[model samples]
Target: MNESIAIAWPTDDELRAVGETKVLFGHQSVGADILDGVARVYAGASVAAPVIADVSSGEDAPDGTLMHACLGVNGEPLSKFAAFAEMLDTPVAEGVDVALMKLCYVDITASTDVQAVFDAYTSMMADLEAAHPDVRFLYTTVPLTADRGWKSKVRALLGGDDRMGPADNVARERYNTMVREKYAASGRLVDIAAVESAGTDERSQDGHTYHVLNQSLTLDRGHLNEAGSEAVAAELLKTVATYSPVA
Candidate 1:
């Protein structure tokens, strides 16, 4: 990480705005990491953080809370969409100012059909938006995995991009590109991938340059460490505060 470049933390007014917003987020472990960062952010600042709750379908969080749940099984991308749409159908989604679901890195593999995943996501989000016209649906890109080091670099040189690490990231990049193309102008995007890959040198192999999770940001292959978590969570809060919900 560059020590000279400063991260843009949420302003006091933005923090207050998000505090009053009722958000429903469906995600897996990385999402938990982000929520951890959210807590750290509020703790260090002079604002009261919103309530964070873990609830299931048919359960509703109190007003001014950020209600969240782990949705779908890993390796099953479509299931996440199904689970989130189902949640939107229940009372849990009532009066929600913002709602989104994030697909874990495990959800997309080298063999996964990125187009199919994108199609499912777009169709489901469209249905949910029509059903809950009052709620603003934020679209999130899938999280990314760190490059697998020497072996991954060699594979990139050999044009063997069919394995799990870099190839899977390629699939994820394709999906994220599609998402950005579709919703780039909508002002409802929370681009987790961009945050994960930022502030680091781009990795290149076989004359192709690509983005990967900044190794300094993770102790493991995919999950975020404290600093990484805080970086991503700050962007998330800042983005969430930009929306003015329909009155």
Candidate 2:
């Protein structure tokens, strides 16, 4: 990563004028690689964009060009939409030209009300648009857990019956479906459910489990390793490229 990446906050006027082509990223534990890949590609293209990592491990440095908020492990954007409005209100520097905004990992299956989650997300985006009109919102889907055993363990830890139970699968499907439908309803929302679903299926077919992190990918069962992240990044890049102004 280059140390000279640019950073500026969009003005109220500028935010309102932002087009549909900017790149913003909202990510989770394993999805950082996807954001990194997007940054690499955009840098290669000489596109002046910013990648904001909402969750931080504190290992990242502020290059002054790109803004890195090291909000720590517990600082992830809340699962509820209303909380997101408060999250976005946290101040970044002025003149930050954000062309795209991504909200990753709003796992509807994990929430009590899938529709309410979707509605809250929609409302949050609407609030962002009102605050920063220049930035577009891209919502990514929750990836499938490749490790059934690990998932079962997690479920057990949470007092769930079984990770592969019919109810659990149904919830997952319903959440993904709602995400697809919501994205389809608005131009501002970009759906990456197909990509995630396909990637998980491919990995399963190949009998590969675990997520990629750093240079060494792991199969710990919760998040993706670096390899898995890169795969996801590639998929998201392909999606973003479709709307990329430079492309």
Candidate 3:
């Protein structure tokens, strides 16, 4: 499978910094893939990887460990936002250096109101920023589902729903555009959609081409495979390694 840009391994100092950075990640299944990829990344570097712990709450998290947890129900974007906020109220947010919450592909559908969702997201993030001034909040684009294959297309033609197709990805792109516009310039964004779709697959619909999850990277319709996990985890680590908290 074609990869994106070459993985830039952090220097020993930066690696140590990554290990020392206290990060809280709220996500669903795909988040697990990224975390697995993180382990692969550190293993490839031949260094002792950071402590990764799955905790029920922030109070259980150890200092300097990358504590991750599943946030809210899938397909309910607002719930995820609220869950992240609730997570911040715990001790994890007290001295956290970096944190992010990611929405799964099922969170947004073709009929979703992108504007409304973006508005809710912005309000929640702004509040979190004000409440946790010491922590750096990272924004993530919503993940994209894979495009329909020829067989799936045939099924769709025969009146079967393709589950998630290009139309749903279009909605995700709309939200991703908002995220990039708000944070890309400030360098506080992790463009997961971009990484997943990079140099991989594009589906043209209504005379417009939209990036979709690289089929090669996914075993299912949405979740990442090993290669996909490593690809995204590399970017995630690079972002955390290079991040500088604002004074």
**Candidate closest to the true structure, highest lDDT:** 1
Q: In model 1, what is the error at residue 53, expressed in angstroms?
A: 0.7
**What lDDT tens digits, residue by residue, belong to model 3 across residues 29-137?**
9999999998887887856788998875545666667889999998898999998899899866667789998999888878788899999999999999998888888
Candidate numbers, best lDDT first, in rank order: 1, 3, 2
- Candidates in order have lDDT scores of 0.83, 0.43, 0.81
Better TM-score candidate (2, 3): 3
Give the Cα-based TM-score of candidate 3 against the true structure: 0.91
| lDDT, candidate 2, 68-178, per-residue tens | 332223223344344344445544423333323333332433333656655665676667779875444456554444335565767777887433333333444566666
**Model 1: CA > 4 A from native:** 1-5, 150-164, 205-208, 244-247
Q: How much is the lDDT of residue 58 in candidate 3?
A: 47
Model 1: lowest-lDDT 10 consecutive positions: 1-10
lDDT by residue (88-165, candidate 1, tens digit) is 888888888988889988887778988999999999999988988888889988888887878766886798663447
Ranking by TM-score: 3, 1, 2
Q: TM-scores across all candidates?
A: 0.90, 0.57, 0.91
